[model samples]
Target chain A: MPVTLKDVAQKLDLSITTVSRALAGYSDVAAATRQRVLSTAEEMGYVPNVTARHLRQQRTDTIGFIIPSEGPRFSDPFFNELMAGLGNEAAAHEFDVLVSIHVPGVEEEAAYRRMVYGRRVDGVVIVRIRHDDWRIRFLQQEAFPFVCFGRSEVPGDYPYIGVDGTLGMYLLTRHFIESGHQRIAYIAAPPHFFFATDRKAGFRQALAEAGIPLEKELEILGDLTQQGGYLAMKELLSRFPSADTKPTAIAACNDLMALGAMAAIQDAGLDVGEDIAVGGFDDIPPAAHSHPPLTTVRQPIYQIGAQVMRTLVQLVQHEPLAQRHIVLEPELVIRKSG
Target chain B: MPVTLKDVAQKLDLSITTVSRALAGYSDVAAATRQRVLSTAEEMGYVPNVTARHLRQQRTDTIGFIIPSEGPRFSDPFFNELMAGLGNEAAAHEFDVLVSIHVPGVEEEAAYRRMVYGRRVDGVVIVRIRHDDWRIRFLQQEAFPFVCFGRSEVPGDYPYIGVDGTLGMYLLTRHFIESGHQRIAYIAAPPHFFFATDRKAGFRQALAEAGIPLEKELEILGDLTQQGGYLAMKELLSRFPSADTKPTAIAACNDLMALGAMAAIQDAGLDVGEDIAVGGFDDIPPAAHSHPPLTTVRQPIYQIGAQVMRTLVQLVQHEPLAQRHIVLEPELVIRKSG
Candidate 1:
């Protein structure tokens, strides 16, 4: 049988109400009495019921993260690394992370509401932000604490840690141009994502700087998946069947897409580095291990995750933040592919 | 301001205690009164405080999963897929998942205790079972509900969904031998893991069936990471510098290790499929996207995660489980690597 508050109170020869207040660390209780109550409770093996404690304190001491997933088949390494960082940091702070998976729509809204309005978590860490994201608006309206992994165009300054996607893409595009590849094609993420727009702008900026004309047919939108990249590359190949028209280099918005592009290139009887150069963004683990290796931009994904979680914790605890909005510089990782 | 029970009581012309009890679904409350109180509260935009409701019901409606991680750099796709399954299934059941990270040992024990004794979770999902795992013993002693993703050597029957690692390795080793590879090297996971023992047994069984004496020096232990696999393969190459004594085929315990081994082999100026064959387990997403594509044993990691979670929910709810123990067959995914 588990020991209860009454058992500890009786053992300490105190009123149950006083004992409860002392155990709860209420300032109204005398320090001597609180110490005595704590010792007695520990001796009696009394484990305070967390649910009841949370009820009185009106705090769950938990943070929430919702993985914006399409389905059960969601296995993005970026999210995995981020989740690891969040879980480790949360554990260090003696807090638990409540995780859920929902696609970005009605289900996602319900998940967030369950975490916020349901009082299941004290704060949330939002990732994969979109332009004018409704999630940010909803959270702000509810006055719930949240920190984002990317910026949104929702019209206010909020706590977020964003990587400069524009700079990342610009570096990759410049590398391709400097390598003397004029017919460069880009496989971009869906335009709904805020980062996608920034990356596209960077690509255009690089082309414009090099006095190269932008070809509308060379820019293809992908679903930010390997299959999407493969299809986009296939479509590009079909559009430019002749050697003179085919792109000499390809740049994908993310590593998965770059990998898919490589596969498509190999299937088309072209050597990756020899026949056509390729580069990617995000520099996922597989990028380093791909056949010819991938040259891409690096984002400290795991560290960013840890930082976002730490910011969310500070917000929940009402602590002063080091920086409310941080834009990290993206680093270029040069490898064999380009 | 949030609506209070007293407000609902006054609006419905019932006692506050009656309204609270009605919301809590106490059988003593009259049905009409309960319905009236619920509707009036909903109309008044009253959201029931979940912490208080859990206190009254002694149920948190949350499940816990502790990721046994070495550090924050833990980016294993196997766990990612499993988590996705667990998260999606939990969401479908309207149950939240509480995740934490801790290395195995004392810290791991404390994490389990925090989830179990602290009453932060109604049940736990245990993965990466060890030989004679103390976690299973503790959960059983506490009578806390839990379901495992792998079986243990503990002395009782428990609910679990496991992949047949022994059979998986047997098929892979047999394939290597049939492909005219007489000299084979095995990269094994840490010996403490139960699956490691099973997989080793399978590797030996296949060699014995082929009448090939197992070369003790050919087997090396890997830390189940790509780096570990690379170092292990390097050590094997050093041990047999002569081409005549070097292993013709390398079988890593997991895909990450196999990828590392491939890198090591390539660094030694050898072609993967032509000079040396490599095989791995747990056909992760990257395994398919790998340069030559990895030949591996496929474990339905996502499905197993969902099944384990479903079983855990059933156990927590005291529902009759369909099976107390399930050992799934592993499929051989023969790719270009082998």
Candidate 2:
């Protein structure tokens, strides 16, 4: 037989109301009484049927994040940091984060629908928003509470906290120009990603500001992985073999690619900073420790994670938010690589 | 009005049994019939009501892992890799992974109890097992289905898949010894961790086999972080300032610490491989990218994760296992660092 609140109240000679309130973590109950009620409940093996409670309360008290696994591996440090931030903040708010790892498409969409319509979570947090992301449209149509780490080009009234990738890239490109690098190349990310286009545009804007003609040959597309960056850099080097016209510096959309680019340059028997400077965005933990310490754009990934969760929680609680749409500035960190 | 399975069956001109079996993912239903039933159910706005179904089935179809966050950060590549492995494997089996990030103490215990007694997850996967971990005792008492990544010192009958840390460290130490280094220092993980003692013992055993007297001062304790490894190496360098008595090789318990040790060696104006060989355990992704690359023990983290989930799912399904306990071998990766 399951123990009830009355059983615990009777055992402690306290009112059922007091026991319930104490167990509910209400501040109306005395601290000593709350402690006593909790211990007595545990001693009596009074298991709180959370499913029933969640159903009754009309809240699951869970947040959801669908992990976008790029390629075959999901060990990207950026995602890890973001997850850590989300998990830490969610836990602090007495909430748990449910993760669904699926590639974007039919399966990913089904996962989201299952979580949202299945009532498995109170709210959701989405990342890597594309220009025409179907996930956002579904969430908006369902009127579910959610927050995104990246903004989409698709029009919608939703809360999002994103790093200004365009400005970030512009600053990085300008830094290279200041270092007397005129023949600059960019290891661009896949064009499908919204931020990829923004980041590349920033690089173009910086080149135009410096009165440097945009060279179509200098822009090499990469998949944003270490290997992708390496291959892209190799392609760029091969395209411009002569030192006189070859790019003296290369800026990757992210640090992983930049690190790969560095490896390619080193493999070509050229000095990293002496012969050609390299820069990257998203200074993940390894960026500071990379061979010569990669010069990259620093995104407050942890803080961004915490803010996204906080925003989602606020929306779940129907609380008024001071600011819904948050755009955080990305800082350009200079290190030995550049 | 809530849509029921019978309502969907009526709309599709099918029997309720067929509709129920199809929705439950039973193989008895024909593929075309199942698809027709599912589309009809969706068109009828039928919500499966997973909570009610879970209560009846006594399964959540979810796997749980409590992420142990250290300090204000949860960026440990080991945990990230482990999580990715678990997430990928679990998702493949149509199981969602529920993560709770909390420091080990009251909150952690509460999170576990909430998931277990609350029936939020069907099974759990635990990592970083301690000698006398309360979690193990509690889970054992509850008779819950679970799998551990690390073995505990406390005697208990449970299934676990762990790497042979002792042998891994011993091989690493032996490699350093074969390089003609008699004065080898060890940067060990915190003593509380089970692998810490095992790894340090292996290092000692290697020295013993070489007929080298063990110096008590040579065993330095580190917290398994790059920062901890860095500080520990600095201490070791200070302890033996002279070149003649200074240790020729330093073996860290993990790669992060080994990377830190490398940084320390470079800071002290010494070449990494020539001045002193450095070796680390757990060849994480960055280990291969580190300047001079790092020689470390490579654990198949992704495969280990998939195996753990497979084992847990097997147990949950009440299947017989040919082997309950498994020990995986750690490979010695030779890189430029050593």
Candidate 3:
């Protein structure tokens, strides 16, 4: 059997309560006694029962992030970067990050309930907020400390840090118009996502402001994947077989799709920038080095990750937040592709 | 205060020992008594004290994977895929995966110690083995159950699943030679990695069999990153100012570097497949969609991940294994670039 609190207390000739308090980092215990107790416990191979400690203290010292995965595999670099950012910052704060990857459905809901009702985490960071996110409602009902990477349409008082996707898309579309492209097209993400709705709205608003009539044929939906973009672009191309009728510029909701669009253009024996200007949102690492390079809207995902964690930490500590809702500006980056 | 075991027992008019055993899912408890205890606990909002239960069972139902990350942000899709595989498989087995991202050194060592000594996880899955991986030694000393994604130079009786990197490299090199290329260059990963040594040895072996002279200038070391590959390729180009002296083919250690090399080659006013045959390892998703596509060696990373977890679960349960050392074959996929 492993060494226990009782074993340590007996070895040190101290009370069990005193030894427990010392190891718990409670200031009520003498500093020298705490040191001796810690060293002896380490020497004796005393592994702390974390579940017990968490039960008594009502804190796990761990933050949780449940990936809103849709399928069997998730390969989005955006999440990878965000996770790295969260993990690094959480580690710096002496906290561990517990990541639960589950497709959004019954399993996902059960995961949230288990983590919250079981007291498995101190707090959580929610991402990929839907139009009517049930998680926010559940978390709020439980009075749980949590923060969102994206905001939901559901009315609630909660902390969130969101990139201004609508404005970013507006800026990108405006840049395309300024480049003397009257016929422009947009490849959008599935319409249910909050960012997808916001970004498409921005695109439409820009076209209306520019006195360019919105063409129903030009706006196509993509599954926010490279293959989805490729198929959407091909469909868009098929609608206008002639150079005079086709859109001179295309804007995708993400860089991966934009890169795919570029490939589609190349496959059609057309020069990317000269024949068809293409741009994407979220200047992922590959955008800068893509063939002919890609113009995109840059979101500070790393900083957003750090900020989200800081807010969640504040909420966990029951500290007052100066501003619960943070909207960071997105930057427009013009390159050879657009 | 929240409801406790005593409160549930008093409410049900039952003994505390019966209530505890029922909640613990012990078969000794009568089915009817367990049902009554569960319903009462749920009605009273009695969240099971996981810590106390863990203390009695000596299990956390969690597996750990510490990423040997070496930078501010890690964006490799390889790890993302592997993580998805591990997470999905572990979830199927009613286990949670706890990931810790830390660079290899003092902090990483401390993380292992903490996870092991704190009883935070039941077992671990190790990745990215090096020439002298200290993690293996440490885990062995603790007698902790672990399964490795890669093997270390330090031989030991441990469970591991490794890809045949040496044979894969030899095949790739031989393919280049069969295409009538005498001056083939290689962009290798950091020398400290065990795969790097094995792959480079294969490259040398292939050239020796072909009766080709080995040129020290043709071998370059990259940091297993796109930027590293870009810089290494640039350096390789600088060595040969004339077209006649430059290498006719190039092989990168991974797809990211290979893509970077392709970009560098394009920037130098040269066609990828025609001017210089370019290939990479790992067959990452982008490799197939890259401009001109990339020839690569494919390692079944997803399967490898699932297999690693299976072996780990077996070890954790102290079950007998048919074979502990599993070496999976790597396939050479020929694309336009090579």
The true-versus-predicted C-alpha distance at residue A146 of model 2, in Å, is 1.4
Across A314-335, the per-residue lDDT of candidate 2 in tens digits comes to: 8899999988788888999999
Q: After TM-score superposition, what is the CA distance of residue A128 in candidate 3 from its true location, in Å?
A: 1.1
lDDT of 2: 0.87
Once superposed on the true structure, which residue ranges of model 2 sit more than 4 Å away at CA?
Answer: A1-22, A25-39, B1-22, B25-39, B45-47
B-chain TM-score for every candidate: 0.93, 0.92, 0.93
How good is the docking of model 1, as DockQ?
0.74
Model 2 agreement with the true structure over B113-218: per-residue lDDT tens digits:
8888777788899988776877888888888889989778766878999898989999999999998999999998877778888788889889999999999898
Q: Clash totals for all models, in order?
A: 0, 0, 2
Compared with the true structure, what per-residue lDDT tens digits does model 3 show for residues A1-338? 45779999999999999988888899999899999999998899887766667767788888888987767777676777788878878888878888888988999998887788777788999988888788898898888989999767878888898888999999999999999999999999887788899899889999999999999999999877788889989999999998799999999998889988998998888889999999998888778888889999998777788888888887898889999998888999999999
Q: What share of the true interface contacts does candidate 1 keep?
A: 0.83
- Worst 10 contiguous positions by lDDT, candidate 1 chain B: B69-78
Q: Let me know the TM-score candidate 3 reaches against the reference structure.
A: 0.95
What lDDT does candidate 3 reach at residue B313? 79
Ranking by DockQ: 1, 3, 2
lDDT of 1 at A81: 82
What is every candidate's C-alpha DockQ against the true complex, given to 2 decimals? 0.74, 0.59, 0.62
TM-score of each: 0.95, 0.93, 0.95
